[model samples]
Target chain A: MDDMTTKDVQEPYTKHLLHYFDGTSRYVLIKDEEVPFPEGKLIVSRTDLQGIITHCNQAFIEMSGYTEEELIGQPHYILRHPDMPKVAFKDAWDTVGSGVKWHGYVKNLRKDGRYYWVYATIILNIRDGKPVSCTSVRRKPSRTQVDACTALYAKLRQAEEE
Target chain B: MRYVMTVSPDFPPGQIAGWYIFNTWLQRQLGEHIHVELYSDFEAQRKAIREGQIDLIYANPFDAAMLVREEGFTAIAAPLSKPDEAVIAVAVDSPIQQVADLKPGTRIAATDDPDVNLISMIMLEPADLSAQNTQTQTVGTYILVAKQVLQGKADVGFFLKDAFAGLSGMIQRQLRVLVRSEIHVIRHVLLVGPRLRERHGDLWNLLSEMGENDKGRDALKNLGLQGWEMQTQEDTEFMIDLMDTLVN
Candidate 1:
């Protein structure tokens, strides 16, 4: 467990340093350890149209449990758990693609199959003639909101799978 | 006061220059017995209608639905042009050539007004299109979405056909239509608040009949070529269906 935790910590920084030289990093720091894991802090990489995982910070790797090498070329959905609904992601994508911010609750899966809930905000970065990348930040969500969302998402997921 | 009926945001308020022209003409017809107040935003106009701020509203199908559902406003007439058809487009160079080409991880751009644009997009869903793994961005306007797609910022965009009329040449040369909706009668509907329904039945009848003469034709021309038509529960039902699809 200790080895795994240590690997998680070093992997993200190494990945960030290797892929992104601009000194910008994606970091997710949990402000309260006592809070539920799903309610903790989360930071995601900013990527361009090619979907490269250019940068990640320590907290992202620690929580996701992937080595730096495993995360870099993978699409963001690699972290997507099976429990999430396709429509929620569809809605989120549609919202951000239009150059508007999307605020919603999400349930993401960890590498270990544990699920977490987050209050997520995503924004698009347009530079020059194209969209450079999108950045997202997530924080521990209210239990009330999560509980309601989980039930709704479960129904939506079931419908999609059917 | 003269009553001004304005189409909600679903229609091109800016393009519908006829509404103002008609309002001025209608004022002449009414001889100052009533005044017109035109509005483009549905939510704002809905609030005004609910609070008894306006005597009449020229609303879209969706707005008319909300009025019937929540506030008991009566639909008086629908516009001549069908408002339900939404055109989905992508840059010519984009990999998305058809709705089926939209795969997981595809980045799609849409307008911020989900109730209007998003609902229209949903109505245009292809039989085999699955929205899995799609990432979407919601800009506030159709033009912004077009600019984004033109600049290669987004892979797809959805907007009304009329909204893109000015850019048709550029779009035809640079972009491809992924899908086009069947002709649904999109209308700018006339609605009366519950309080004014009985009191103003004659006004409604007169307005509907006004298009039979030169003065009426001029007034109709001013109101975006929308002449007076009868209101029906069916018109209200169409709007309700749109609203239901939006929420679901």
Candidate 2:
């Protein structure tokens, strides 16, 4: 997967074993930093059916610290934060895959290894009478909402660990 | 104090700015005695219902049916969506003029709601298509699904006639309706929980009259609804059946 380029990643559903840096290293680096999502600005991205990054707006690219070229052919999960519970992603996939739009607060890992929180809505994109890809629109979340999600997510992640 | 809540799960929590504004206006119209709260979180509202904490609740057919069937909630009022039909739409310039023209693997998009999704499922049946044969995306909102169709991301999109009617001019002009379902019932139903019914007898009549006056009319306009009319057993039953069928 490391050697694969844009041409190779374009094929949908190319499952790659994601080795998270936080999980593998002897001493994990934690950048407990927060970047406020610009108010009223939408951060948008589109992924293929298999969750490969297809297109992203400037806000998404800039926030993630990845260039458009770097992001276009990569897996969308590259920006996934470890703090998020697997159940959240599972629910999100099941909901949208079953033809429901899903809304949730997501904490994302940036390219700089810092993290940010967003309230994201994931929807399915269909064309020519078939399911094509999914798009996610995200915005800055309120402090109160984030605090609640933070507590909820911690409980969820702990449950998974047990 | 009486508690009133509304569920629009498609919207994100804390992001329902306009909806919150409209609810606040409705609270004022309902007078100081009634407290109105709009919740976009399904789980939270469902929990409240299970605990018998909520009084009057507004919800989509699926949730309303669940509340009615299991929790002793009564459907009282519902919004009357003019031209209330399920519609399938495609880009105006797309060559696909009919449902039969759609090939296997064609992408169909609609809101994530099961009732709304069922419309597309039923429409695709004429072409001998099922869920497995087609790629379906559940969009978060009707306007987004319409936008997907117009942007060529989705070949087809499904939304109730009222949602299509509410589309922005930019979206409406870019897409054309491919087909429409027969008339359907109201999308959202207002229900009074047992606790509310026990305390507030005949509250339905008062709530149903919300659309009759000027302040309520202005609020409804802001909320993008036409009017509230009392629901019938037939209307509630039809919606409940649709919800059950989707579940089973």
Candidate 3:
């Protein structure tokens, strides 16, 4: 261990971090509350290349139950509800990472531990012909949509864990 | 990686050879494999851009606005002191001498060059003319617009100032300028995508001072440029804001 080489030091730590963060949340809590997403209002948030939140609109703050100051510098995955299949976010990253738009039903955890559902569309904000950031616009999802995604995500999460 | 460079089709046909020579200069200056690809019209060029096929471009003001905002293009430089302006004209033999004489049904010829059209429409406001009151016939090029006015198919024609200048002297003699826009801030710009960003600083240095050298001056002459001037993000953002205001 004392004779660890430069190549060994760089390779292991890099691969280790990638595995730890991939589709993983930093924290989670559960509470018996469900917040209703107001109709006709869009919830928008912008994140940097690494998925750190940069900007958020008023609807995002209200839906997430977080203040603007608290939300700006956090990882967007802070809202990763336990019910959401990690593969859903992985798919979102894969699509937007390749400079394509991603559309999906997302269940998000609020600051107080309640959950809300949204129909989300994600796109990259480009500069110098490279994607530098991402913007996600969310709208209210129908009850039918939420129920379908809920059932589908449960099956996916079970398959992933097994 | 191989890179593609393109220009707005609005450039005069006389400058086609000039651009090939300039492309050669760019390759030598950057020491990279850059290929030239030109489109016949704005629609085709925009299609290529959206598909992410272009690595660098010398774009018109209107398309430049879209590139900066919608696409991930960075503006590097623009032609020094060469702001784009619009010109409105009538045939030398036309009975209408001024805009004031223009009637509600006056026939107008125009191209879809957005910036020029915006300014041209504003100039027509003095005559109580508008999209509803005036008759507009969209043509393929400034040349066709000029031809329509000369043949009396249209009583008036709209052209970008440089495109009008590119017309032959005989065409110039046959037309009378009703007015020309003096908005001195809008111009064509050179931009690069992320692929060529590594050369951004060096490209700017070479371009901003190219007018001082002998070979560069020859290339500039072919493109009708005096020199390249530095364009920052703020400069481009300001112009985009102005265009949005005009559009709204």
Question: What are the per-residue Cα lDDT tens digits for candidate 2 across B1-248?
Answer: 65666554643333455566656765565553455555445676677778877777767666776787778887777776632357788998999987667777888887766555665565665454568888887766787898788878888998877677778787888888887765234367777777667544345555577677887677676666687777765457545643443342
TM-score of 3: 0.59
Off by over 4 Å in 1: A1-162, B1-5, B31-42, B112-116, B123-135, B166-168, B183-186, B238-246
List residue ranges in candidate 2 displaced over 4 A.
Answer: A1-162, B2-4, B10-36, B41-48, B51-53, B81-84, B199-202, B232-235, B242-248
| Superposed Cα deviation of residue B136, candidate 2 (Å) | 1.9
Q: How well does candidate 2 score on lDDT at residue B90? A: 91
Give a tens-digit lDDT track for model 3, residues A1-162. Answer: 011133222322111111125444243445556787663355767799998999887888988988999888888876777777778988999998997778888998776666798878787766556776777877556566788888999999899779
Q: After superposition, how far is residue A48 of candidate 2 from its true place, in Å?
A: 51
The C-alpha lDDT values of all candidates are 0.59, 0.68, 0.79
TM-score each candidate: 0.53, 0.52, 0.59
> Going through the candidates in order, what is chain B's TM-score?
0.79, 0.79, 0.93
Q: Assess the local accuracy of residue B211 in candidate 3 as a C-alpha lDDT between 0 and 100.
A: 82
Model 1 misses residue B152 by how many Å? 1.2
Please give the DockQ score of every candidate, comma-separated.
0.01, 0.01, 0.01
lDDT preference between candidates 1 and 3, better one? 3
Residue pairs that clash (backbone atoms under 3 angstroms), model 3 = A128-B194
